[model samples]
Target: MVNRHRGETALMVSGETLPMRLTLGALAELEHAFAVDSLPALGERFVEGRLSARDIIRIIAAGLRGAGRAIRDEDVAELSFDGGLNGVIKAAIALLEATFGEDDASRPPQPPA
Candidate 1:
């Protein structure tokens, strides 16, 4: 389940429920890894939904750290996903949503004139 308020998304990892999200520190790490000028660039790069395997590892690593798990990309790559590739993809989506938010659902409410 995704917790918008807490910026956390729960995922079953090797029979354990792990919470994933992107903290400021995690985001910075990603920015450095990707060599992007800003967070928006990072977001924009994935806006089209195309991600390389390395991208997935980076995102997952950052997410694990955000959830207070001190893990590296190598560790993430070595883990087994119960949901398989699709499950990993779902977790990635959850992480992205938790980080950048779910587009329309995240937009601030418009005030009535």
Candidate 2:
């Protein structure tokens, strides 16, 4: 359930807010990992809707393994769903906001004549 309001998509988990720093870190880490593993092609396949959630998890696991990271079976299980994806995206946004301060609206918009 993607909710778009006020020009921002709401990516919350269980109605709980995540800290910006953590979220950003997670997003950055995921992106960095993907790049390091040269899995953009796989990601493109996923984006094209050719990959299932399990396929994505498998790709991620393989990437992790290639990077000398140990991925437990449970970890793969945990990431195979919409909830996990939402959590990751939300966390990334929070992290980005933390790295760069929140946006400010100091000036009022002019009314249409």
Candidate 3:
């Protein structure tokens, strides 16, 4: 009974493990989708000062489709490490911000009389 208890404890300590390869695949797909679709929109929003950091992250995750199951907060946290999905998302956001200065606000606003 002691050995069984120890085994169970070990399993519990290990926690839920995500497969490394699967995670990598998901990250790659997310990166690709962001590059193709969401990045431009995010950039536009940033230029307009309408995109927050959290909003950028959420948009990137939402842009990922048919990659796998929905990415959870835990996955986002895990991906924030070096060479991870979070890094990719941040990079994309930075690129957009740099490329498009906050000039959208200069445009004439729509009248709502």
Candidate 4:
């Protein structure tokens, strides 16, 4: 299960439900993987929704690695997806959104000093 409010998502990889989140290091890795010159550029690229199999694998691998999981691109490529391609796509989107989605706006205002 994914807790959107907490930026925690569970992905089925290698027949296991692995927790994933993106750290600053993971985001930087993604920028480098996509050959983007800036973080905004990376975000824009994903917004365009154009990616190859290798790209998906890399992105998911980064998320796994960020969560302290020892996974590689090759391992990611071999993982079985019960939900097929759609599941992979969903997991990728969930991972990205969980990491970079809008800030929570429902919290109560801070008390005055």
RMSD of each: 5.2, 10.4, 17.3, 6.7
Model 1 lDDT tens row, 10-112: 7667988788889899899999998998989989876879988889889888988888888889999988886988888888888797677666565899899
Q: What pairs collide in candidate 2? A: 20-94, 23-91, 24-95
Q: What is the lDDT of residue 76 in candidate 3?
A: 50
Winner by TM-score:
1
- Tens digits of per-residue lDDT, candidate 4, 1-113, equal 54556677778755778877777888899988888988788888988888888888888899888888898889889989757788888898988877766665855677899
In the predicted model 4, the residue pairs found to clash are: none
Q: lDDT per residue, candidate 3, 22-108, as tens digits?
A: 123433444464453454553454456564555545434432321233665344534433445554455445333333434445668
Q: Give the TM-scores of the predictions, in the order they appear.
A: 0.84, 0.30, 0.29, 0.81
Model 2 agreement with the true structure over 40-78: per-residue lDDT tens digits: 542443355454455445444443333344665358556
Name the weakest run of 10 consecutive residues (lDDT summed) in model 4. 99-108
Candidate 1 backbone collisions, by pair: none
3 against 4, candidate with superior lDDT: 4
TM-score order of candidates, best first? 1, 4, 2, 3
Regions of candidate 1 where Cα sits further than 4 Å from its true position: 1-3, 103-113
